[model samples]
Target: MKNLRDEFPLIAKNKFAYLDSSATSQQPKCVLKAVDDYYKKSHANPHRGTYCLSVEATNAYDFSRQKVADFLNAHFEEIVFTKNATEALNLVAFSYGSFLKKGDHVLLSLMEHHSMIVPWQRACKTHGATLDYIKLNNNFELDLDDFEKQLRKKPKIVGISSVSNVLGTKNNVKQIIEMAHSVGAKVLVDISQSIAHEKFDVEKMDADFVVFSGHKMYAPMGVGVLFAKEELLEAMPPFLLGGDMIEYVYEQETTFAPLPQKFEAGTQNVGGAVGLKTAINFLEEIGFDKIKEIETELTKYARAELKKLKFVECYFTSNAKNHENVISFNLKGIHPHDVASILDSKGVFVRAGNHCAQPLLRSLGLNSTCRLSLSLYNTKQDIDKLVEALKYAYEMFFKTK
Candidate 1:
């Protein structure tokens, strides 16, 4: 634990219990230095410049793309870097919508981030298509019976999250993909929450598009990934048009660049890509499976401890054997915001809100809940402080009465 704590110097100095890794992860020194090194040694526009520094920078960025591909076990040609997961989902929604005709349907799950929902909503509006929702059962799992009913509507696209950011429920993505494929719907998975914990192979999942954010996986902001099938990339039109994405621009006609670059218009995030590469390397060195194991144990402990508090009304299942590294719950007769305020006083940090899944929160009949999300960097001591803080919060907010 000391070694792990020593690896993250800021965690010790700040003394801040950071359980909000779902929003963003703390970058290690290696990842921080990678961004700085790029600025000092290789700062040039990628793929366009012919100078030595330019070529070096281009190779570094391209290599980063390959690293991302390898990380997800997909082809380099299939990975398209975007500003964030929101932009990635928009790329698919807009480009794919261009081919959609009026009255076409797009099916989405109730357990989606706003990024996954809003873009498709706009896409359906723009193309005069219809958007339908697959229902969720009492336990917050996707209702297959309801999904089968919606399949009859002949949806052109099916969008879902691999893991719920609020509920911490891991969806049956492989089965979801197979079912959607049987109905001839292209499946898009929002892997922003799952990628950091589990191994994901696009081929095995059979996803048409898989999107995730770098910030969630110990990388810096302003960079994310959108992986698509090769034929689909070739078929869909570019969402944005600019310098790097075009082959030639004339008064009459223009040809777009191939596969990835066609989608990534403009100069691109060169330094962010370098940082992302470093971040991925960090995860690989630590071993994602090991990270998962540590977090799984901690999450289980936290959930079990939380359930024991008389004031806590757990929203998600306490059976930590099933959930991911997230736990959301409410204190009896106390608002979630107040609970967060008390925890804040004790140097504990947790999210208290719908967590960008407002629709799902509403479905759960909750405006908000205190969320404790774990990462590989988190330890038992962090959870101990949180549990202690929760006990204090309950006593102050409810037990006093």
Candidate 2:
């Protein structure tokens, strides 16, 4: 795979295997330069400014927004910028979720991150609504039959991930969305894990809401995109109340701004958005087809190698084609933290712990597991480092036995 490994300065300098891209990707130099240029050349508050610099800043910010909109094939006013996918999910939970009344149900899959689960839990509790989950099958993938049955609950809304952050299992979201909509439920799909590896056409996905983090896709942290239909953005109330989101402030009464600006309260991350645009540009230049080709090959290789280590029990599906981005497994009779620490000493990085999906871990009867999440930038050498580190960890823990 002809990857842009050298474009990332940190990746070039470090002798480290950064297998944690699902958490957040390393920023390319182009993306970093875009962010730097935004701050240095175009630094001002956007949307309400009249001065030259403010106008320039506003232009840059809007351009970034439009870039994202075009990428998603969404309306110009439909994309709202937030700090991260966490905030974007919270926005939907509080605002669009406000439509929920007593006895209504909210459904999500078992494999969602806390960012997706907790907000709906609280929202359901506050609104006197019911919350349910679509169970996972033996393969650790979402159970389609169970999901269809859950739709019998006639949920008001459903939140699901396009891909599980922990398991790397891709959901049949288009079919799931269809089922949810057949039962008159609005679907919100979190693509935070899959965004970097796969292509998305939100209009085609036919979901009411989509949330993703720019950092997870290759931009700097502090920028996320909330893609909703313009009508839905109009229907929902703003999540945060602050300066820039206002239309007019009266002593006793205030009016809010329209569509995108209404949800973006406080000072926006203009620099981060600029970085996001450049990051998207970088990926588009590579083409997602090639990105997926490289990652799938690497993941299959990692899985096959990990599988050979009989001392380790993989939490992944037996079908290597199913789980692509992440590989979660544990060394037999060793704490995941200990294994992760050993891998760290060898400059082989991977994540340990519940990965913010405590429910998913509990379902698997595991407190935690070491996770190797793949990105297009990752190499077979990175996989080799991880495999060798696992071998060392295994020997350290159970050599006497």
Candidate 3:
């Protein structure tokens, strides 16, 4: 109900209908100020210097980690900061996944982003594990029957997305995790798409590992989080071995730091972490109830408006009502890139391409699609602008013939 665009200077000034929250969200003034303030006042190498400024910097960074942990109902020690979700997944693949032996299995879903897929693919190749996929149903949601059937294969690890970045389908990760665990499989959930829009409680879900990027949640880029149980992190070898990650160094051998610091190597994006904390605070201030209410209304309105256009071919099934804020479609006979270009010219920003989930798009018999993703800052008016722009594109490209 609240017009959140005012809080985002770029959105307010440009007045662009930003419908690509799935790609990366616009930052609020508060988040920007938080990053700026950290650089201006608390700029120092955290955990390296004993000076007052360094101590403050370390505290700020540590506090942000704690904030993130609390945000996901996780233990502080369980949080490991990475450059992005890609790095987080790679960390798991290189560290925890290294334990896989010959003939072991790693189960992934059809809708996983490339970030989730590539790492497992490489890991399986390295460890002689077999990479398997859980097929999608007619509704583009994960086929639970196939998932259970795959579990019988006794996978060593199962990786899945909480929400499909391409389809906007909210998978039942909890149920999948339960099923995987029944077969003694450790589950890693990619929360990059769901963390900003939905309620994610790591403890409640009991996920073995969870990864998300700050950029997708109105925070600064260059910061991501990997949440795993402390014991699991302690057991896994450090992904990156370097200066800060070590407890002590010898000519022949080196000892690593405890829990999280063992995984966070080299200098970190301190400002990004501060901004991420601020962004979480901003979301909390708005609250999830209001967030969901706005997104639900926008999604329904957009879906209805899009359906009215005969040329618009929406990929969602009729019974698929849980596509929170993403609509993937193709204007009949219009290339996705062309549709996106036309929308851009009209000051409507949307995403077009495989959305980094080519496998999922391929499953749907599409190479690419024009995606309109919404956020709390987006409104019905924004959807209206998108509809108008799409209609204009259709007219310009198809009706002329």
lDDT of 3 by residue, 1-401 (tens): 45688999988888789999999999999999999999999989999998999999999999999999999999999999999999999999999988999999999998999999999999999999999999999987789999989999999999999888888888888899999999999999999988888879989999999999999999999999999998899899999989799988999999999988999889999899999999999999999888888788888888899999998999764554657788899999999999999999999999999999988888889989999898888888898998899999999997678
The C-alpha lDDT values of all candidates are: 0.88, 0.91, 0.91
Candidate 1: where is the Cα deviation over 4 Å?
A: 399-401
Q: Write the per-residue lDDT of candidate 1 for residues 224-248, one digit (tens) a residue.
A: 9999999999999999898899998
Please give, for residues 1-401, the per-residue lDDT of candidate 2 as tens digits.
33488888999888999999998899999999988888889899887778899999999999999999999999889999999999999999999989899999999999999999999999999999999999999998888899889899999998999989899998888998899999999999999998898888988988899999999999999999999988889989889998889999999988999878899889999999999999899999999998888888998898888889889899887766678789899988899999999999999989999999999999888999989898887899999988888888888877778
Off by over 4 Å in 3: none
lDDT of 3: 0.91
Ranking of all predicted structures according to lDDT, beginning with the best and ending with the worst: 3, 2, 1
- The TM-score obtained by model 3 is 0.98
> What TM-score would you give candidate 2 relative to the actual structure?
0.98
* Candidate 2: residue 107 Cα off by (Å): 0.4
